[model samples]
Target chain A: MTVGRKLWAIIIIKIFIIFAILRLFFFPDFLNSKSDTDEGKGDYVREQLINRN
Target chain B: MIDQIDLSMVDWARAQFALTAIYHWLFVPLTLGLSFLVAIMETIYVKTGNPEWKKITKFWMILFGINFAIGVATGIILEFQFGTNWSNYSWFVGDIFGAPLAIEGIMAFFLESTFIAIMFFGWNKVSKGFHLTASWLTAIGASLSALWILVANAWMQSPTGMEFNPDTARNEMVDFWEILFSPMAFNKFLHTISNGYVIGSIFVIGISSWFLLKKRHILMAKRSILVAAIFGLITSIFLVGTGDGSAYTVAQSQPMKLAAMEGLYEGEAGAGLVAFGILNPDKKPGDGEDAFLVKVQIPSLLSILGYRNTEAYVPGVEDIVNGGYKPWFEKIPVEEKEMTYSVAQKIEKGKLAISALRDYKTATRAGDSILAKISQKKLQENFNYFGYGYLNNPESVIPNIPLTFYSFHIMVFLGFYFILLFIVMLFFVNRTTLEKKRWLLWISLWTIPLAYIASQAGWVVAEVGRQPWVIQDLLPTVAAVSMIDTNSIRITFWIFAGLFTALLIAEVMIMVRQIKIGPKEGGSK
Candidate 1:
């Protein structure tokens, strides 16, 4: 492959590893994981804010 | 509703985020600035119809590609970190913060990715004018991305156009345009991008100097030096101007950060700017110990830079902590009579705000609209000092003095050095004896790393100097973290450390190999 093609391949691989694999396994979105609805998320945040303080 | 916070967990999460951010920053400035340099070189080639210029452009473009590919999406982890490590901070200001980031994704990312494809592969496939346009668009895309991100960050420093919604428990954008056109945003974007420009110029000239040192591509080296030195000279000067603007903004919005940067403990009119100083390790707030053990200063310079008036009062750490003096400028939405407050008073007000929020929530749940309105009004009155309520000790408001002070001085000193270096380079590049100046060539090559150091130092000053606060007065760093296991964050921190180190090693090796290959002979179309 040309150098540009090889670099592009690396980039694509990297994006997949970062966004697809690592994100799924390691870095779950906290609010989304805890609650699917906006109201639920707001309740969670309020509870955390008031109770934690 | 955990009563006790795992402070260790918060600290570890902070470390992880800092580690990722530091790593991500290593590549971003280069991408931000080098794209434009490459575009400019391509423009010259198109204008002159010179194959030699085309070869130079291609050579630099390949280096730019290597950097862009390796650095791209490294910041993806940083964004994810917001969800994983700082979930509360994400949800709290996400309404205000997420807008710019979303815009950045939709506008800048697509624009950049599209044009970059054409710029890289369309050399002979597309018309020359079209190819040049793609190159310029790619550069603009990178800068536009920076603009949105910087606007978001500037909001953190001097939050504007945002209102606290007790119902959602988040700061929501009330005026998007105000947030976009904030004074801090303007200064930060210009200063940060100019720093990138200076770094890009330094990289070009430094690498070109290496070629000259090895007695290879002498003509190309000279030509690159001529263009880069002039570019570097202009941007470095602009960097100083923007730095001044930043200092002034910090003085107005974050007096404590300014005081920490100067290592000042006593308020004064006509405060001298510390040119160089060593902090007294024994110094503590209100202890009357000398703030600086030894120092040199430019008289009244700090006052002038900060307030644009030589006699304007510049408060120090003690004054900020004790807080009796009236500020020259205040941005917080508070009653005019309540403008001055000690840290202790602010903490009291912040606690009131928190209590009012709790009451508002409870009242809403109990269907008490009248009580809810009363609580909401109280919360707004005290909300400016809301983050202060979380602190147990008033002095906790002070950031790390020594780190902030030293970083500021080092960055300032380097700014002057860069200007001088560019001037010398511009002169020497025109002279016949340029190639013979082996010492100067070595200095030029060494400057590449120094430029990176200066760039990093600027961030340290900005970030560390505002310590303990995630968003100026609204959220404390300790309060902003996710409730996660400390050991998990610790493990991830090391994982990132190793991962980023490996990436850095790979990038350096690839860059050096490409440099060894050098530009193509007789140039490519």
Candidate 2:
């Protein structure tokens, strides 16, 4: 392969590893499990801001 | 895209958006500016048939390509983030905000993307005239993109051409043209793009001055410096007018933002402009303690600048919160607008609206038509300030004052300083004095970062001053996040930060190496 092709191959692989692969394993939606309804979610937000520990 | 209504959710989302915007900005302004510079150089090359000019154009073109590539990469994330992080905001204002973004994609993106290839690789593949057209089109495309995005942003600051729909729980467009050509949008576009022009000029001058310092590309450096300085000087002066127009728009549409930007806590008819001041952090307005630790001000200047009247009352944060600015709100178009809400009155009205929405929901649940109709009337009447109802405390309405105030002042001070620097440089440019005056060259070289900083500060004053509410009176940021893990957001923020930083380092290294290589050596084989 040419140097240009070699560079492109590594660049694509690096970006995929960092952005796509790591994201799936590490970042899961935690806020969804916190509450069910919108009102309950709103209350949680207010309490966090207004009555913070 | 679900509502993640929590503080950490909001914080992490905000952090991610801010990080992306900050990184995106570091690249976008240069692309905006350099594209035109390269186009101009290419035009010169085509006109004069100078191989030297072609080489010069190509050198800058290479830098532009590197910058544009990263800018495009960062920009996609910003657009996507509305769905990923600010899902609620997307749904709420989607009817209004979605249109401009769609236009930008269709109009600006296609034009830029199509022509940019020709600009970069079309040297001998396309005819000479066609190549020049591509270069110009690419520059115009970059600018056009800025216009559409600013239109959307400015609409958020001063929401015109849209009305609240109680049924949909959203703001819908009433007049497309009103939103597109809003006074706020026009001012923002002009001010922002001109700032980009100034940034471009400074970038060229700064890099050119560096070449002069080392005496490497002295002829090209001198030519670049002369060209950029003239362009810089013109735009720098015009920025004052555009900046004034921005302040006026803010005063008329977003009085609280202007008040917070000034750190004024009390209403004054003839408020003086703060020249320089130290704000006393502990100072409270009603307590009668002066907010200024040390202040020097031009009397009545703020009132005149903000309201164009020495006697026109400028309402401060305290006045706004305490309902003293009711007249100001009443003055905003017709009292016919459901949105003409003063500070306390807005929250009260918003709570009523919220109550009505609940009632409507309850009535619907019971299948009671009559009750639903009654609740709908009340909901529609007070729907404008519904976002304010989410607030538990009135004080939450006040943005972080010191941050807003300092950012505004820093932007202003640095702006005037740039103008003065350009003026002095313009004076000495033709004479041998420019090269002899090492101090000016050194200052100009360093001022590049400050120019970028001023642009960022201007945005800070704008975005920070409108705090709590992401859509002015329409939506608070707390209610605008996607349902996601705080760690998820945190992880993404770090990932983006890491990637952008790595890319930036690589970019700087490449740019530096290319710059050192000079146009002659770096020219295409």
Candidate 3:
């Protein structure tokens, strides 16, 4: 292959790798969970404990 | 007494953290080390005018693709679990944790993603310079992601740049820059990223060595090994340095963790660093009973690491466990106890009230006082705080000691080994004798497993060492979990496990197939 074509290939490969990484790492809300809100579901339990005391 | 509820919360949170951390790491190291390898490959192609270099880059890129996909898939669940499993923790510390995550999204994610698309699909369309820029951007993005995640994690360990807000019942950021640049954050970030680089390099080296052994793609394999070795040497050296810095930070910020890591049991000046010991926590150290069975001590190491002096006092596990904070539960005053109890009760009562009100409204609309009364009685029953006692004293809270202790040691041992290995590799490569040695090739290959083991160990130590604390000294892990049934946790766990397993298997299969085909064919494709 010619020098330019080899250069083009190298450039293309690098771009592909970069794009793949970006898509993988750029995820928003990556570590946040939906079930976390369930703790808020049982406020009555706490209120009852306090009232009893 | 720290009851079962507290301990179970810790166990649950820890299990979740461990599962996510182990899976996340399986992806991250590859990202770090592979990016640098690709960069080097491109550089070689530019410098040496070798099309084979281009071929090598293409081959690795394919493996990177598979790993990247699995990494992304496994990684997304961890974020969601923050809300799902640890909702109270999210409410309490999300103000602090969310900042870095936001920054990670804005600063690293966008830059990485934008350029990555151009890089991946724009091969024939985009300019050479633009594509190279994209490659560097992806590396920057990966490193940046590590930075933000470490910043958040370090803050959890040391809790800097944030103050408690009584109104929100949470810790909020006072200064974003302070949290970002905190000593622990910086040290941990450097240590983690360097480890990632080591993992990436070792992965390349190991696979390349396998290719060389098979006499497949001889020139391509040799060049890949040489590149991997160089990257590995540099990264491994830095990994050790950053690890020392991390140890120092841990000593200062969490003396208890340091004590646990070393398996020390007494307050001692000029303490020896234990190389290996069966830690009998049951017996007191230096009671002349010899609690450390077959103790091997490197004199003055612990003292130097902890206090910057060989004679400074380093508190041991016994000191930490016995001194003031013995039963962590007893430390909470009545007011804080009342507040927590009240909040939990309010949440429970509110849920019941809402459900009862709904049932009553439905019964009244249907003109049925009997049904309404039944719903009212059920609501009243649910409103009772009889279950609160159970919440305070949970069942099924046991420490998995063997796993915890071994994981901690594996991480520490790997840290030291990588330091020595990297230093030796650097010396050999600098002396221009790197290529002539077949053993270095083998060592580099073996280092792949070490990289993975080290990552796993670090995570195990982080999650397991913080047993009983989801928010470190504040919230227990069990209390942080969703009130979902055990069957729910089991089902979700299995489903996640199954899906992740499938993805992982597919990833390995793709990588193996690519390696088998060799880079020469890969490049032409």
- iRMSD, per candidate, in listed order: 2.3, 7.8, 12.1
Misplaced by over 4 Å in model 2 are: A1-53, B1-5, B326-342, B521-525
Per-residue CA lDDT of candidate 2, range B276-326, in tens?
888999976567788889988989888887877776678887777776343
Give the range of the ten consecutive residues with the poorest summed lDDT in model 2 chain A. A44-53
List the DockQ of the predictions in order: 0.59, 0.12, 0.06
Of 1 and 3, the candidate ranking higher by lDDT: 1
Best model number under TM-score:
1
Interface RMSD of 3: 12.1
Q: Which candidate has the top score in lDDT? A: 1
Higher-DockQ candidate among 2 and 3?
A: 2
Residue B5 displacement in candidate 2 (angstroms): 5.5
* Cα-based lDDT at residue B63, candidate 2: 75
lDDT of 2 by residue, A8-48 (tens): 45457545654576434543333344556655444444333
Report the lDDT tens digits of candidate 3 across residue range B1-525: 224233444444456556656766787788877876786787676567667776787787766655664565356567766655555566657468987888888888788667656655565687766777777788878789778888888887777676643223356789888988888888889888888887887787678767655656666666766677678778777876777777677776666567767766566878878777686656543364555666677999877766667766677655554443211122454245321233244335545543564565567669898988887676556543222222332211112344556677788788777656655655654444555666876876688778798888887666566554555444445445544344444445554565556556666765676678666543534
Q: Write the per-residue lDDT of candidate 3 for residues A1-53, one digit (tens) a residue.
A: 53224334544543443245423332222123232342332232222222322
Q: How accurate is candidate 3 locally (lDDT)?
A: 0.62
Which 10-residue span in candidate 3 chain B carries the lowest summed lDDT?
Answer: B389-398
Order the candidates by TM-score, highest first. 1, 2, 3
Q: Rank the candidates by DockQ, best first.
A: 1, 2, 3
lDDT of 1 by residue, B248-284 (tens): 9999899999999999999899999999999999899
**Number of the candidate with higher TM-score, 2 or 3:** 2
